[model samples]
Target: MEGKNSQLQQRKDDALPRGTGNLCQWYVDQAENATLRDVEGNSWIDFAGGIAVLNTGHRHPRIVQAITDQLAKFTHTAFQVTPYESYVALAERINKRVPIAGKAKTAFFTTGAEAVENAVKVARAATRRHGIITFGNAFHGRTFMTMAMTGKVAPYKRDFGPMPASVFHARYPNGVTGISTDDALASLHDIFTQDIAPQDVAAIVLEPVQGEGGFHIAPPDFLQRLRALADQHGILLIADEVQSGFARTGKLFAMEHFAVKPDLITMAKSLAGGMPLSAVSGRAEIMDAPGPGGLGGTYAGNPLSIAAAHAVLDVIDEEQLCERALQLGAQLTELLHSARTTYAAITDVRALGSMVAVEFADAQTATQLQQQAMQRGLLLLTCGPQGNVIRFLYPLTIPDAQFRQALDILGSLLNQPRS
Candidate 1:
């Protein structure tokens, strides 16, 4: 007799492509803040937070009600066609909130990739240049243009022939990997000298704190220098906040931690509290460079997602999630540091608020820890070029008791001998 999970796994294997990988084999039945229940009634602590898409947590009440209310009125009128008030209103809110100099404007999209690709378009239009520069290990998106911008090669760019041209990668400062800030700046200069001249580059895009490539925080000085370089070369600076936005990093956006401002910012994932909504917010002048009809999609600003995003903003403010993220992050960081004494394989532990990650000596050790944690009903996600980094994306809204319990599970697992 096959169990429910086994039966569903078999069906999934038959129906889904091999490329659509799943971290957990069990099918989810229901989910709440920081927890997921499988079809077999087994519950797991959700540390992955749906790949940083659930910063407000699963099915937040306010977000749910907002989506439901919008569903009552209408679903999609297509902003490019009918143009709803909610769409403009959401854009206005994001424009007001995003970190950009002078006046800012925001345009909505359905995915982070769409926002990123459109940002590139805006940059090119504004600067009248074609080339884009991104840092190594950054994960922009899977779309053709974004794939070209993305730093990682393996599975993301694998088997996909001929990425769009005019995109280049620079070395991102990673202390663990022994790449210093000077090395990164030198690499960028080398790119300008060897591949594309600074005048030909339209934008330099990067994650304030990298997500998929590894949880490496871009140093403050590095960002400042990049800002200076962009100004000197007339290149636009873009911060991809897809995985670091919505109070996950103790700030609404990771760029807030830096003193220098970017010309544009790309955001998604937690913007709608689990609903699919992405936006590109930037300087009003730069954004307006793209003439009418140059940007937009059939489902650009879905009404339900707009409503949920509005609710998400309210929830973040009312709940004081930013401060809570700092508190929880400090706790988790302390716990990981304590575990370091016992676990020799623990290499590095770095964090910016709750966006935390632990690196192991090898990919096998990281995988072993993730599997052992999963067996104990705790979900974890791994990243990095070597697949040796375990990132913690737990919701800031998680209850204290549940968060502590998850930490306990991790501590116990760390105490056990390596598999």
Candidate 2:
């Protein structure tokens, strides 16, 4: 009686956990650079980019070829056992590319969350301290430790209590939310004063651009100040570039925009062109703090994913995706501002390269806008504590004509009043 997707949705509701949030009702049968098609042959412009995980687009030819070649060679030997060259090569490439200073080293992992957890392990081992300081509104990961590090509670941290201890949270500086750099610094100072002393802290972790925290861009000075603080107290600084890496923010890494460099950088999301791979690149000696057999996973740096990552790197450079991100960012920002003239409820439009988000006056309007867009074959995603922000994560490889079409749909939606 109904469409295939509608039937599947019913099954999904019956089988899948309620905890698993499904933003799109239709199940995607296929995806291209910046669009998705359902099993029923309905097409939708993909603005979510698989939750900022497809900057290189869905199955780039280069990535596909790389994976194919690797598949012919061998699938898994486990890096710790019969190690492969591709894994080593990928690590070398990441070490060179990341913004860490002085003989950086890299270790691979299977997911962004693993990279983060390992980064903390390396920090704690290097500093010989167990205390970690994160920020409010930050979304590090979903694991027990990361859940503790994460600031939001409702969806991610709800009923997942008894999180790891000694993980403190300070404020993440967001100009849109009125949390100034000074205010954030004050919060950090308070953490040092009230919770854990600076000397006992292992690392201060933060996102270059808060991805799920409403796409808030951290102030330039805020990171620089954290660098200084870390140095003063002998604490490592870790930039969680999981969502903002691989040219998502114009630079190869978002930290490059800042004057200072973090001690370690965690990269995932678009690292392997849709393949599952993540890495932690950092100072050599610090990275070496973990003893033999101290870190690693069987699936970490699978040859296929490593090969795909190499291809993703090549695609970014050759395709000039960094520059493309900048160009797309300009267009998106301009469109949002223009729409703001018509819809004052569109309070803010934040952009850092192609990573853009439009914040509405309230959560209801934002959710309604996302539904409105989806009904017109444009997929959208909302984030923020109150769910009042719609983040744009279209692929950098999106065709120009398609990009404009998605923009037009958004512009039209902005003109409509909340009924």
Candidate 3:
């Protein structure tokens, strides 16, 4: 059966258009903890963690059991037609847990892109404005509007032309580039003064930690000032936590580090232990601005996905994964830093919790490092505008021994002289 599947995959790739990229070998048989096995019987320690979707590790027993229990009871009810308790209970739990101060409400969706899109819809409905502001190097999604919001061009926005309008990009405060919080604010002011008026802007959408554009941590002061500015202009502040939420960043949500209260928060990736689930949670008043019938889909909150999400939350709390993330992150960061002394090519080493990264001097070097690591039975992902950053999203549930082994392998590789 495995042989047949391999042949089928090869045939599919040959027959279909190759616009979408493929990763790793052709066949993946099984995965557990922080390792994946290809059909060829090679095992590779997974550092990418499905781009931060396996914070609790691959196929966590609790999450699996939850899915099994829900599978036995009936899968889809189309929430609008027949609501389920799991969905309501999960929503209630998220409402109570998301790091907002006052009353908050949540709406579930199928993907991170959907969550982001819905957040914008809710913001526009609440503020009755037509413009949205985002940061340069931001990657929201692939949809028309999100592509317009995204700042990167080569791959994501290259062939996709005539994107939605009224979405403007601002410079994020990047200390490495000498752009300060005040500079970011000034960029916003320039946007309002030279481009779009503040009164016409509905919301300012930003990632607490920029994911695809490189692991750039947004300064706390920048987020605070954006919050204040949004309030002053009666505009919504949307925190896109799709990549940094669910304990991937020590806290339940990355915005917690800044103590900024955004009007909307979009989350996904690790929310449901690998299930296709996402959510837009925020201020009750603003979320309620959208008409009752305006916010729903056929598979918005699948019962099976909701059950898995509940178990995910339970595991996070019960296992104290957030604390574990912090410790593991520190260990990895130290290891990377120690190796950097030998590898002068490593320019930056940064992380929050287990969401860590090391940027190389250029895309060629980063790609070479990734290939070298994969050849050594470790899988790593390269992300950044220039593809120079190697980000680590190992599962929080990875065994200490396995993590240490992976770290040793990485150190050995990075310590090698540039070829």
Per-candidate clash tally: 0, 0, 0
Higher-ranked by TM-score: 2 or 3: 2
The digit string of per-residue lDDT tens for model 3 on 1-419 reads 55745786788789978776766654678999898998777899999899889999999999999999999999998998999888889999999988776999999999988899999999999989989999998989888888888889978889866888899999998765688999999999999999999999999999989999888999888888888898899989999999999999999999888878888999989999899999999999989999978898989988888999999999999999999999999999998888777888888888988779898888999998899889898999989888899999999999999999999889888887663
* Model 3 regions lying over 4 Å from their true place: 1-9
Per-candidate TM-score against the hidden true structure = 0.99, 0.98, 0.97
Q: Give the CA lDDT, 0 to 100, for residue 237 in model 2.
A: 95
lDDT by residue for model 1 over 95-115, one digit each (tens)? 888989899999999999999
TM-score, structure 3 vs. true: 0.97
Strongest candidate by TM-score: 1
Model 1 clash pairs?
none
Q: What is the lDDT of residue 188 in candidate 2?
A: 91
- Better lDDT candidate (1, 2): 1
Give each model's whole-structure lDDT.
0.94, 0.91, 0.90
The residue-by-residue lDDT of candidate 2 on 1-419, one tens digit each, is: 89898999999999989888688888889887887999999999988888999998997889999999999999998899999888888888888888988999999999998999999999999999999999988999998988888889978888875889999999988777688999999999999999998889999999989988989998888888888988999999999999999999999999999889999999998999888999999999999999998989999988889999999999999999999999999999999988887797888899999989999889999988899899998989899988999999999999999999999999898876543
Consecutive 10-residue window with the lowest summed lDDT within model 2? 410-419
